[model samples]
Target: MSAPDVVFVTGNANKLKEVKMILASESSKINLINEPLDLEEIQDVDLQSIALAKCKQASKLLGPGRPVFVEDTALCFDSFNGLPGAYIKWFVKSMGLAGIVQMLSGFENKGAEAITTLTYTDGEGHFHTFQGVTHGTIVTSRGPTDFGWDSIFQPDESHGQTYAEMDKAAKNAISHRGRAFAEFKAFIATEFK
Candidate 1:
């Protein structure tokens, strides 16, 4: 059987890489295509709402009978009660790795969570969102801080390595985005296949 096509809307090449990798296992059943769309990413605290909005916007562009998928991720700091929860992108841009460490320097409890919400639809006007969160601590910089707060976030399931430290497969094994996409893969295998 030929692979069914699905449009994945995202400008970030890294995201496309990860999503493609995740869907690779199911590639025989699903053919994923990248479509870069600069949709208005709402800064609302509700992750689901933000994901749903983006999914709807992207799906609208694709019109009817076309499947579209979109994802939104956030880094939530317990020290700040998830402040800048859904705004991690801007926060990371403004505050570098050093700034993040300094901000949590005084706090004894450095609890944090990495949340990823994946919203997808078959252009049936029924958008569905799947979320995954990794519970970890806000530790001092351990590895390269090249990507977002990866250096500072040490997932409890990832041994002692931060997201930035682990390679693509290793990180995806225990990442918020990976977990969410795992669910997405299962969904696609069943629904679109």
Candidate 2:
């Protein structure tokens, strides 16, 4: 049987590409794509809640009978006690890469976690949330990639290489977005089987 058509709503082209790759690697029956829909993203401390709210809002905006999904990624720092939990996007934008390093300079414990939350809708408005998390520590910003806050964050399983330092394949193998997409792909495969 053919899987349900999935529309991913996101503004990040890098993320969209990565999601396509992850889903494509999972099964042959699924089609992956995205639509640029400007939906209100509520400022919530919880990544899941934010993604879910966006999913619901997108469903209402796009009307019914469209299986759409929204993804939200955040980098939460333990030192700040989640001060920038879901607001990591804003933080990165306002602070820049060097500023992030400065933000952690005073704290002895620079632990952080990368979180990716995905909310899927079954066209009629049913929402399913899938999450992925990678524990790591904040390092001095490095690498040439322009994607988000990747330069400063190093995953525990990355062998000391930051996300920006790794290629697409390496990053996908252990990234929060990748893990979340992994679950998302599995869910689609089973549900549509």
Best by lDDT: 1
Candidate 1 at 103: error in angstroms? 1.5
Tens-digit per-residue lDDT, 109-191, candidate 1: 78898999999998878787899899998877887766677888899988788888888899998899999998988887789
The whole-model lDDT of each prediction reads: 0.86, 0.84
Off by over 4 Å in 1: none
What is the TM-score of candidate 1? Answer: 0.94
Tens digits of per-residue lDDT for model 2, 1-193? 5555678888788777778777776546556667888888897887888998999988888789988899888888899887688888788889887888789898999999899999998897578999999999899877864888888988999999899998888999899999998898888877676
lDDT accuracy of residue 190 in candidate 2: 73
Candidate 1 overall lDDT versus native: 0.86
Error of 1 at 108 (Å): 1.0
Candidate 1 has which clashing residue pairs, if any? none
How much is 105 displaced in model 2, in angstroms? Answer: 0.7
